[model samples]
Target: MKTMTELMESNIKKNYVFSFLMNFRLSNGLWMIYMASRGMSLTQIGFLEGIFHVTSLMMEVPTGSVADLFGRKLSRSIGRCLSLVSILVLIGATSFFHFTIFMVLAALSYNLESGSGEALVYDSLKYLKAENNFISVLGRQEAIFQVSSVVALLIGGFLGTYSYHYAFWASSGIIAFSVVYSLSFTEPPILESVGRNSKTFRGFLKQIVDSFSLIARDRKVAFLIFFVQTILAFSACIFFYIQNYWKGLGRTEFQIGIYLAAGSFLAGLVAMKVQRLSHLLKEKKVLIILPLISVASMWGVALCSNKLPFFMVVAMIEAMLFVAGNDYINKLIPSRSRATIISFASMMYSLVMIIFFPIFGRIADTISFGVAFVSLAVMASCLYVLSMYLLKKIG
Candidate 1:
């Protein structure tokens, strides 16, 4: 029989392995290009992405609730299975309806892990009495994600030059490893001890109410969730759409891959330093700096002739905030409601994406990428000002 220390170590290490496998999504960087190749307009692609966020918005919380009430291991295993299925569907999809199905499946896969995985890792660390290390651990996870992204984008871009199907096929194979790793995870005692009664449907609803009620009452947690997710939504909008924009500029698959891979590499480096940076800058300064970075990057992408520098900066900012913000919010949430509340935070990202993605896509289709970027800059700046105001009021 394994000791508690052994079990806790197993859970944490296994989660890293599972995360590495799941995020090694070879088709991620080129999926937009693949859809465009299928004779879908950028506007059509935008709507498809909108469908994804809508599904995520609906499913994120429920799936997270299941993870909290049931087991993170089971939730993760199911999500990996769904991810494999989604990739298979993407491989054969031709029509918009087929793509819609793929998007929904993909979104559900994302929703399942969006909060469950974080909660699992955190609670596992908590079991080890290493909860204070969560931010540093989160940084390592982000670094792992970028490492996977670097390899996937390089190979997927190469495969995409020949056939997008090949890239997606490789993605499916990678997700199978995720499934196997997820099943090997030992559930943290934290959830079972605190969440035993929250397994029923009524219990689930109560969990939701209590979680949101906590958020509603906690200004700092609410601010962290909204501020982080809102900026993240903006960053994601740029990253995906930039794939199309770069293609429109006549960049080859290999070159586009290099561009994205470079950003991922830089982000990975930044992610590893998130804890150090946070400590150095202090919390308030870090918060102020991140929004300014977002605002400047957007405008740079819009106005400057060279956008790659700005693009790469956005990637680093994203990695930094994701690690730091998750640590902050998770510190505030109780164990029983942790997954659900974090999922609610994730749902905010989906909500913002659903609203902004289609609008930006329409603008890009009708106007120009420059104008679309400018629009994002303006929106980000306004949000920053409002966020600062709110922060000041809370202070």
Candidate 2:
């Protein structure tokens, strides 16, 4: 086994670039959601988030094909550049229309990134004869990414307390650094064989079709994708409801930031240990347990009236299970079409969210936050059972 230090030295530049981009992107995650909520009505916030999902859904296949054809490195660079531009727009924007434009731009950038970066990293590892270690490497990368998220959340929250645009401005600067890093990235030679034919628009479409067809042909992949969609939908509801939940607890945006940071920090720590955990627990078993734990955590969120204990438990659950679940999903995916498959899976997830977020938000707005959360928990619990059964039958 490669020591962590050895892995870092061998892939220093690539890993650093990935870390920078993740830091830039995730640092603003909580802040952006907070801003959208503060700037607009809950309904509008839902709409904006839905738009982000819709844009990603629309772009998923095309962008996946772009990574497939043009090479993941090139596609990732373009995505990072677009992300930087989006952050800049968010910094300058004030009006609802302007915010919408920024949201759309940001969504575009995220859609471009959905799978390209991981594909590039996987391809690079293959070149280095470390393909067999992809799961552990990916887990490590996720840990780094989550650490960046924790840092970014802390900083962004502080800035957001002053002004949301302050957070946006800081995010823009981070994205600029990410863009620079991405531009310097070199594609691994293994990708060259896959890039034999010069790519055309028509070829890109065909590749998209082929990727989707391949996914459909594999029962395991199809079931996993649907399972991922269900899990993400529940996850989305919890995250989306957090702002409102914190408000009920009389927490300031800064305090909420602290809570978000705590969760992410824990997630980072757990992500680092995922490979070891996977060795002890089968991936399918982990998947089932993770979502169940997530459901229980959300139920705890629904029940808690206090702040510190609420946040602590939430962070613990997220770190121990949620991050581990994500790492397992990454491990299950095949290297050759990892990005495209991930993108396709994400697109389906977004499609589900695009429909569900609005309804869930409206329910939170009209009925009760607790009601929406509990409903999600119940649905997630059911999905966990279903996923376990499916995986068992398939295996």
Candidate 3:
């Protein structure tokens, strides 16, 4: 049998493989275009995205608590299973209702993995006495995500032009494999001590209450969650809707895939360099500047004829924050309820996406994608100012 340290090292490697396999979402780059081809408008697609986030907002915390109480490995494996189911549903989807079903399942799948996976990796590192190296590991993980995304998007885009069904089917196969791969992950031993003591119903409720109470006491944690997640929501909006904008410009699916893959490649490079960049820039300064950069990217994408540069920059910034911001937030919380609190952060992101994504879609449907992006930029700027004001007031 391997020692604890050896076990942890194995967990880290398995996690990287799991994350890579999970992100092979070939359907992502073509979902909107496929729905459009199926006679759904952008507004309808946006509404579907809203449904996803609404489900995530509702289930994120509970799923995170499940990971905290039961086991992170279990949570991750179940998530992959649900994702596989969602993809299967998506392939057969025709009407709005069918799409909504798949979206809800996908959101539930995300809720399970969102916090559990990160917390699992962090705890594994802690066991190895390398918790401090989490950001570096997370950076590499994000880089792997980008690399897989580039490959998946390229293939998906080419296949989707022939038949969206092919892309969905390809994604389903990858997710099915991930479901099995995720099961090979071992639960960190730290969880035995960190999980709630009593296995009763009340213990579950207290675990949740205590997690929320921690957030209530730590204003900085609360602020960090809100600030980082809100920015993430805006960045994700740009990433998805930009496909529509490119399609309107008469770009082929393959060409658009290449464009998105380039952005992902650059983002991967930035993710890999996050540790060095954070050392040079200071994490505090990076956090402060990130929102500003996101705002500029949104505006540039909205107004400029050449939008690729802005898109790539936004992708890079998003990847950087995933590494740095999570490291900062995770340090402020305990392992016992770490997944739950992180889920709260994701819930905040979903809440923002739920409110804004549909509205942005409607605006695009009514006017133009450019105008919708301009609105996003304006909203992001106002939110940034508000977050700063709140930070100062709280400080």
Among all candidates shown, the one with the greatest TM-score:
1
Q: Write the per-residue lDDT of candidate 3 for residues 24-93, one digit (tens) a residue.
A: 8999899888888888899999999999999999999988899888889999989999999998998998
Candidate 2 ranges beyond 4 A from true positions: 1-13, 25-39, 191-198, 307-336
* Top-down lDDT ranking: 3, 1, 2
Instruction: Give TM per candidate.
Output: 0.98, 0.88, 0.97
Q: Report clash pairs, candidate 3.
A: none
Predicted structure with the largest lDDT when compared to the true one? 3
Decide which is better by TM-score, 2 or 3.
3
Scanning candidate 2 in windows of ten residues, the lowest lDDT window is 189-198
Q: Which regions in candidate 1 have their CA more than 4 angstroms from the true location?
A: 191-196
**Tens-digit lDDT track for model 1 on 1-395?**
99988998887777666667877999888889989899899899999999999999998889988888887778878988999999999999999999999999999989888888898889989888899999988898899889889989999999989988888988888888778778887888773455556677888888788888999999999999999999999999999999999999999887899999999999999998989988999888888998788789888988998899999999999999999899889988888888899999999999999999999999999999989999999999999999999888887
